[model samples]
Target: MPNPSTPEFAVVCRFQGLFPKDIGGYEKHRTRNGGDLGHVDPTRSHLNRPVIGKADWAARTIALIEDMKAENFADEIETLTRRRRKKQIKERMAEGPRDPWRATRHGPMREVILTANRDWFDALPTAAAREARAQAFEDAARDWLLENFGGDVVHARADLDEQAFHIHAVIVPKVQVELNGTKRWMLQPSKHELIKDYEAAQDSVGAHFAPLGLKRGERRAEAVRKARQAGEEPPAYRQHVRTADWRKAEDTRIVETRAELDRRTEAVTAEEVALEQKQEAVTGREKAIGAREDAAMAKEKEAGAVLAVGQGLAAGALDIEDRDGTPALIETPEAKSGLLSKLRARMARSSSGRARALHVFSKALARLREKARDEAKTAVARDTAEIQSADETIVEIASRLPYAERRSIGKIRVSLSARIMALTGRDTSRKTPAKGEDDESP
Candidate 1:
């Protein structure tokens, strides 16, 4: 026996074909006049509850077919009609009526019942709560019918007197027709499009009620297959429908699984974003450090160039009194031994030896002069290149420096001058003789 506290889960969507002969019998059952009180339980039925919410037994079914045709097949209707005269001499002609209802042989209407397991209602604590739930389910079922089935829903009612609260809706299966540029509608008797596949319909109904904690029952084929796999005797009932309680539990599990997956996905996405941000920050810091290092290296090179120039001047290998403030290489001690020194050395020799020595010394003096001139030019060129390189480095550093740092360029120049003076042991701040000016002894 099922527990009273536990709700049974079952979403039932069953369709019954309504032929011309079956309409009267179905109407009688809907009206509760056929003596089928099996659905009614006096102990369970709520007081003052209406048995049927809607009814329309006197509705003209044939007129509904004609109206559908007139609306959808106006052009085809004219083609099917013929002109007729009341008398041979009468001038008036009237169009004969077209009858499309004669063709329907099978399904004139469809009865769809939407219900849930009895245990679902039994689990509800109060009669009012059960009534509300049943009403909501009925409304949803009616909406589903109108959305999926393109037909006339003539009647709909909720049967609270039944074993389980259920909705019964009557639908006329009609299709729109277009012929000769005119719209027409016709009733489909052979095939009801909505309930063509019973299994597919059940699946759809299950999905519709899944949010409400009601799911489809198991299929007969699946139950048979499972029974064969288990090597057990098949149950008498081919279908293995789950109870309302079981369906509700399964739905809860599915919902929780989906929620967990979504949370994990969100977490992974957030982590990726954070990682990208961290990488970008690291890259920015590295670039900043690289720029600072480059500036420091350039300053070091500039200082080295200044120190080299100062060393050359202190060694007397270069003079710093040039017009453009650039250092110039001076004559070395070796270059001072020119033609005059050679002639003086040769003067003490015998006439023939002196003449021969003079000739050799003259050639040697010429080569020495040429070599000295080339050496002075090379040294000047090298010093000029080094100075220009240092100047370019300073300019580049200044351009890359921030606005606040750029203001220190003048201070940097002053520092460079002080460094040069300190290395050369010169007091450059004291007054000194200008280029080409003589220094008077006081």
Candidate 2:
């Protein structure tokens, strides 16, 4: 039998700063019995204690969900949503009798999530080596946080030894004093939000440090000021100084190198802006030409259809006069009775020996009219199909273009139906198709 795969290791890190005022009463109402909230376990202890005593954990998790919804962090939500059932402790307390001290006991706190793939690191460095690496990463991470977020890092600890190598940190923001001398930590809106910003900043600064073999947070402020005076962007200034430090004998070379890089970056940014403006101009002109082509095509088809119908009507080939003074144009039950009248008029106008000729001719006229109507209907159908095919082509073309220039030409069904109706002899004052009607090309 194959050896079982190593069981996945799990680690958790949490921080507790303060408790709310009505926390004790809430715990009493929350627990099956009076006990420390953090010591309870349903699987073994079951003494009415919570696995995590910090009520702020439940509150902050809810706040994280709201923030995720605002920032549209959909990738992280699956992990967050699964933990909702574990968050029912707050709901259970809210059902209890009102307590005046609830707000005091349930204050805000910082929360962060960090994890590593333990399987990759299972080659196992010595304890001393692992600690050194962890400390180095932590120090690098902290320096990044201070520069961007302005906070004093308070604590860092691993969650689990066997499974995942992860750290949890608690940071107190720089204290700001009021005009009256009261002081408080500058509020961090969300722990997850802060952690993400820190991670992104580190990635940016760390990548810059790696190629030159320079450690992060090493460049002095004076070098940056001089480079800035020479018109370097902040990141480029630091890069130049770090590269010079690595070379150690090239002070003169560093100045010229930094100046050249800055010039190149400015040129690239200007080129990109110009290209975007030119693209926009080209798109605008193409759209104008397309709109004109569509209008002309529609107008041309309309003129052809009118010409076909007018020629047919002028020939009087389908027109019939009835003996009862009725025209064969009106379509109704009363008008259909005039069909017999139309037949009698034909016989009266026929030769005396050719009485049956009128009946034969009347039948032939009915057949001819039906044929003409069918042909007209088929012509409209063919045009409709062509129009629909054209619409699909337009959509396919627009999809490949950039978003700002991808103007909608409307749906093939609605627009094609309207255009086809206009080309044929039908009303098109509505947007939706008639019930049970297939949307074909014009």
Candidate 3:
């Protein structure tokens, strides 16, 4: 069915180029009179009838040959007398001068199918009426073929067994041409002027059906024509083949393509799996690095905390005092804050830590002993110098004193000398005028 905006039908005319090898198979498939068919309704096959001549292709070929035989083309067409098949002349260069691989190749035969996509015939009120219209439609197609193609339109039949009513016609292009420098006959269907190209054939067929109110089909080959018109290089042309052949070729191509795609997909999957394993290995290495960084950070934090505690002690905010030889807590309130208290508690945790602390205290006490000894030696040197100076002064001052005062000062000085020696553990006496010599006589 067609919409209101468009014509209710469009014409469809298809052409299949064939060789003698291909003709028998197509004929069998079309007529269903000799071969099997998949889509034909056998019950309705009786309705199928000849639109131009008989349904037999062989009989039609023979009759056509006889017609040509009776005419001026009788000798040229005698090549087909043996049969409506190829007459190959294989060249034998080894035996003669003819090329061995070279042989006469035949031009192809053409088959045309004429129908429309309109459901007008099927829209008839009754099956009998529909059947009558279908026949009439095919008859019109047959007449059109004969008028346009003449004797070349050898055989046509209406296939009513299919969904659409259509006519199949075989057209032979019998032309006389010089072959191998000898005159011979060939079926060069390209010689038909109506089918100069597919578009031309379609245009003529569409025009014929136009009178029946069917629209022309879209021009598929128009693009190629337009390209040529635009002065571009001609595109490679795709020759049309029978639908069955096209289907078979396409099926094989699709199967090969799918197999190639499957191989590529498997390769991609393997690569992806390898990439995932590599990523996992990289992730493991990253985790190991993170753990090492965490340990380093912990050590740094502990060192920072210990440094802060030492700074606090220098600021007099914290102190340590031995319980046996010292009095009270020496830390300021600032030093006993929650953070420092926690640090102190952590540091003083076990008996082992206490023992370590005691050993450290003993080392500090020994340092103090060395410091005290240095101070004591400085004091003893100062005292010894003072005592010597006093002894020398006594000798000078006694000479200026009275006899009595001299005797008294002498006794006191002697006592001082003995005490200086005892305290310093060294002699401190200075020389007195020989023992008996009087400073007063001098």
> Candidate 3 — which pairs collide?
none
Tens-place lDDT per residue, model 2, 1-442, is 3225634322222223322333343334244255332323434333222222244543443343344333332222333355553454355335432211114222343333233344423434686666555455445444444454453343334433224444444443323323223222233323434343433433455453333232233334555666789997654422222111334446457778888989998999899889999988999999999999987765555444433323333444334435563233312333344553543344334233132333444455668888999998998889768766775666566566554445333354456566677878677785443333233311
lDDT tens readout by residue for model 1, 362-389: 4554577789999977876676567546
* lDDT to native, each model: 0.59, 0.44, 0.65
The TM-score leader among the candidates is 3
Best to worst by lDDT, what's the order? 3, 1, 2
TM-score for predicted model 3 compared with the true structure:
0.46
Cα lDDT for residue 28, model 1?
Answer: 66
- For model 3, the stretches where C-alpha displacement exceeds 4 angstroms are 1-12, 31-53, 59-108, 115-140, 150-154, 157-167, 173-200, 211-238, 291-335, 338-442
Error of 2 at 22 (Å): 13
1 against 2, candidate with superior TM-score: 1
Taking every candidate in turn, the Cα RMSD to the unseen true structure, in Å, is 31.9, 41.4, 14.0
- Model 3, range 120-194, lDDT digits (tens) per residue? 667778988887777667766977898878877777888878768888888877876675344545556667877
Q: Per-residue lDDT for 331 in model 1?
A: 30
Q: Worst 10-residue stretch by lDDT in candidate 1?
A: 433-442
TM value for model 2: 0.21
After superposing candidate 1, which stretches have Cα over 4 Å from the reference?
Answer: 1-8, 35-62, 66-106, 178-184, 189-193, 220-442
